[model samples]
Target: MECPVCGEHLGDAGQVLEGLDRRYAPCHACSQARLDPRAPPPEAGQPCACGRRPLDQVMAAVHAVLADGGGLAPGAPLAAVGTPLLHPFPPLRSPPFLPPSSLILLTRYATPSLARRLLAEVPEVRGVVADRGIVPGVGGATHDLLAGCDVYAEARFTPAGPLVLYKQVSTCHIEAPRPRDPKVEATDRAVRRVLPDVFVDACAGVGTLGLAAALRLVPAVVLNDAWGPAAWFAGLNLHANREALLAGEVDLLASYADLRDVPAPAAPEPVAAARADQEILVYRGSLWDLPPLLPVAGLRLAALDPFEKDPDRLRRIARRWQDRAGGEVFIP
Candidate 1:
């Protein structure tokens, strides 16, 4: 019998049946095939020797190998399995997973021995680190200490532009450094398409969705978060992309409010010549107290994204803003 994927010959019907049952369709030689025809295929994906056909199964087998921590050997062929597929392959199909490369694996509370073993078994693994006390929540919860590197930098490229943030392992829980959620991004894009004059980012963690809109469409932006640490990081990220923000003709006012007593910062001055093109104001207080500090009439857009785990707060914000006048309010 012949393997349908790589055309490798199987000794007999027994071998074919055994391979199919074990999810090992392609023979060992074909499984280890390299992406480049000229280069020697590295020894990886041997455990996923499933002889499946029609390409998709082969790709799935490869994905399973990487997810299982089997590690794709460096320079092993991935294009042969990935390129021919009609649908989009998973993100894991890329390098460092498909044709494994030097990777730094991060885990929560991973011991030294476990780290060492991971490095040893996976030749492509370059380093490993144990992230301690990282919990999921809003305000001062997530931080990671890399094994070798200092001053972790998170770069996010949004539809608005690119932003770089500096983070350290501290008590404060900030949002994980990554692109904005696709749904959130889509919502923001939809709002920006209307070209609103004023935009408010309520609960702007690292200011991803809000900043994306502020830097692209709106002339003025109010970025507010209940968490001081998150607001601080948002300010840092705003400054990091200051030039771009100014070029877009947007004025930024970032604040940290507890929504109890302290008021939100006022909207940017309407007269461009009277105020700085790009200004940043950071406050530490509550967001509920921000209404008096803002203009009552002309708010064009408001994004209400909170981490309180309750839908009521979002609804209240939406109602308050909507009552003032008719404007688009996005809640995610």
Candidate 2:
């Protein structure tokens, strides 16, 4: 190829630019005109470093890859002919769930062991473990250490047949049976230490908090979520804990979107019925819709983990709980 600027002979595409997305390459010297094919292909052209005409091969390869898959892994090396190579991360888990091995492979390839160690060095991750039972290392929780971790440009690895590009995490999932997010775990610890008899865990994802809360609260634990997956998981988890729940104890709210699904006490015994009647309700909804929670009767404590960043939502939810029971809410 000729340099678009000086008409000087140029090396391969790599010699022109550090990376390749399209066919055209820019001249390292002038960095002006793009060195493009004389007969540009029918497809749209990729810009070269040197400003010239558009490119062809870039789109051809990109289209071919996308039609077949998303493309080679984002950072995989190019072929000898400068064709990009795609990579994918392997599955970490098994039949249904992702295995941990994928994360191990990603950590080894995308990041150095030293970087993983550095990620482990972050105090918040361990603080989550220390404060709550949320194990920080693989199999525990996601995002505990991600607060300040640096995110690189996404990468690609093919653990499965198709090449996929995804952002690799600095930390792996914690390998705990009942791993909880830091905030929920902390709240669980607080509730367990204080009001273990009957506590409500609102917005229970996968019923982790509610499950943990159930183990502690005993006899009657109300689990609620609207997301189909979470609801499904809640049922699965509740079924797994049936022995404890049906001891005239557990109340599962698998699909309750509104207040209608709250269950009646199962046990006839005064203590068991009282425990059952002292229901802990959980639900899933948005932050703005939190107003209805204001009038809920016999409500003790509620935890609302809204995705909103607004203080008004938090204040409103808090005020609602205050009005209902003069109670406290821990918004995570």
**Over the stretch 1-332, how does candidate 1's per-residue lDDT look in tens digits?**
22112233323212212322223124444433334433433333432423223233233343334434434333444432222211111112222122222233444433555445544554333344455544423434444433322123344456665545433223233334333557457656766566776666766665666667755746656666655545655555555455566633223343222321233234421111112553434334455555554444454677777665567776876787677644788775
Task: Give the CA lDDT, 0 to 100, for residue 54 in model 1.
Answer: 23
Clashes (candidate 1): 25
Residue 248, candidate 2: C-alpha displacement in angstroms: 5.6
TM-score of each: 0.50, 0.37
